[model samples]
Target: MAPLKQRLSMKIAFITPCNAIAGGLFVVYRHAHYLQSIGHDVRIIFADGSQGRQVTWYPNFSVPVSLLVEEAAAPTEYDAVIATWWETYYDMFHLNARTYLYFCQSDERRFYEKGLDSPALLVERTYCDPRVRVITEAKWIQRMFQNDFGVEAGYAPNGVDLSRFHPEVAPLAPRGPRVRVLVEGPGGVPFKRVDLAFRVTARVPDIEVWFVSGDGVCESHWQAARVFKKVKFEDMTPSYASCDIIVKLSTVEGVFGPPLEMFACGGTAVVSNVSGYDEYIVDGQNALVVAMDDEEGAVDALSRLVSDAGLRQRLSAAALQTARAWDWDQQTPIFAKVLAGFCERPIPMPRTARLDYLLLNRLRRLESAVSQLDPVHMALVRSRSREISASE
Candidate 1:
């Protein structure tokens, strides 16, 4: 098939939450940059003032909130309106043009007028508009919408920063038995299942757990659990380089970025069998895949890595190869094709008509059941639930 192309003059506006900028922001920013690189006029608008010019490596343009008065007031003039999250979904919902949802994170109900507080209803009722086209980071999310939430959906997987995160580009080290495993991102997220790392550490006295959850490991959780915590994103790679295996055990996920980074860093990974992980890595080949219900599985996988250097090397090599294949340059075209075609095509409505109600209730129940979770945990579940609900 011929590659899709947009007219050079088409302008695209990407609306996202704020400047604190997490994973979803990073993905959207990269998408905007790639869009601009291919000659489309793209700009990003956030709640805060301005995020300023895009760095070449982190190429995404950010403008201040001042532009929104006019832009949001008459959004129909733009070729397309792209909402990066649920809040942005609301903004695009209010607009007058073809609307597209870049449902990056799993937080779908936040866009609703009432949020996911209602379990009895299939939708927020107020946010039930189904006219917009939806795009997400994984087929699992797509299926969620189609099967549960009943929303029209398509899949556009998140891409790695291959230029920065590559096996070839990362610094190499001498062969060693000391493994340096990292659990990256905002940390402390219970869904991230960092506690499982503690289980692994406890089972295998030789392995240590290094964390990136900013608050550092909770004294009680760490003291009782014996897991170590460090709070930094930049420091993640050196830790990855040093580690033989990296593990993430999110109960629910959209698109897992850290494991892909592990691949780029030439580190093998053991991940929970979440929908998002299935999109990228094949079990036992690229990375170890453990069932979510199997709490000991994570510990066992990590222990095996600690005891077997040859297995780690072999898996790491396969992971690096997998990571190379997932480069953004190659994946962006899929998004480009979908986005450009989105301008002309109608969204594919979800097949399971009951999905909308089922997913809406699932989201509500999940959120209610896990409200006591910490910010990181709550955010992770909320994000994943919303993704599932919104896709439906």
Candidate 2:
């Protein structure tokens, strides 16, 4: 007899801006894919319609998908309706559903757009809207929403597709005599600090740096390196596999996906000492950590990694250990539980959750202030960061 898969009691639909090559969008697909695989009737509705389902990860995705051809295409009701981005909320709020969820991946309030109160603030307010239950991906993001915005959101980290990024790709893969470095660019996103990453690439000698983005930042700058447009999701592992190092120096990130993706592909990452992944990364153990503004630190880490192949191997192996626990198989059920809780009502979070939020949130604020201070002010603040953390 065939075993039946556990299915949701009713249908669920996720509304995405488009099926584009983006980390957040990929996370959405994973959520929908997992739900569909478990016998749930999940659908991906295109909010942008014009994106027209052009390029999916492969020939086809796991679940049935539809497009919002007109205003009528919007569903009158569902088991749940998830808005993948904040802008989608304006439309989603009007739609009928048993439950509404904001699948928040970052602090959308930080994201800029023009508005009467600033477009970013308007997005921030959506979290406070009683109609939408908020689900955030990273702990740092949970802290941000809870402490700053007073929204007690659910936390569900995005899981890597480990089968596609198998360890087998790492063993004796083809390599050239020269080293390869990879950098990601969203072009104008301030905190992503793509420009800093490109600068580090330029400083390194005798290595090829590849710029990967659709932002066309390379069209205006960093003309020396090759630009590889974002490939299908299935191809991403191989792309990371071909690289010796992944360097990201984003000033603010709840959690960046590229580093974890590179780790799974048997590569080492040199990343910024940001809040979110501080839980997963130990400076010299799994991956190297560089401060956001430390130009010398960034240069030295890359230069050293290029010169030391053994260090890369050790880091890669340890990183795989870190990656194993975060795979989709582990995170999926936890995600399902969060969704299931909302099916009834907002689950009561432990009292400790609030304390953790205030502490981490304030520390992040202090950290950001120190990062932006003049060298003299920063030196004093660093002296007090530990003290503040203890006293609070």
> Which candidate has the highest TM-score of all?
2
Cα lDDT tens digits, model 1, 286-376, are 7888898577887788778878888888888888888888888888767766777777664533435334534544555566677886667
User: What are the clash counts of all predictions, listed in order?
Assistant: 15, 0
Write down the lDDT that model 2 would get: 0.70
lDDT of each: 0.63, 0.70
Question: What are the models' TM-scores?
Answer: 0.73, 0.79
- Those runs of model 2 whose alpha carbons end farther than 4 Å from true positions after fitting are 1-8, 69-75, 113-116, 170-173, 188-190, 214-217, 220-225, 346-392
Maximum-lDDT candidate: 2
RMSD of each: 8.3, 10.9
True-vs-predicted CA distance for residue 118, candidate 1, Å = 3.9
**Candidate 2 on 1-392: residue-level lDDT in tens?**
12225433567888877766677887788778777777777877776776576556542576776775553355456778888887665445444567778888777666675663244644655666444678888888788778876777788887776887766775223557777888875766677787788778789898877667644455466644556665666656666777778888987766778888778877778898976777577889988998876778999998888888888789889988888767878887677678777766743323343343334334444555766657786566445544533443
* Residue runs of model 1 more than 4 Å from their true location after superposition: 1-6, 48-70, 73-76, 100-116, 119-128, 170-175, 214-236, 346-392
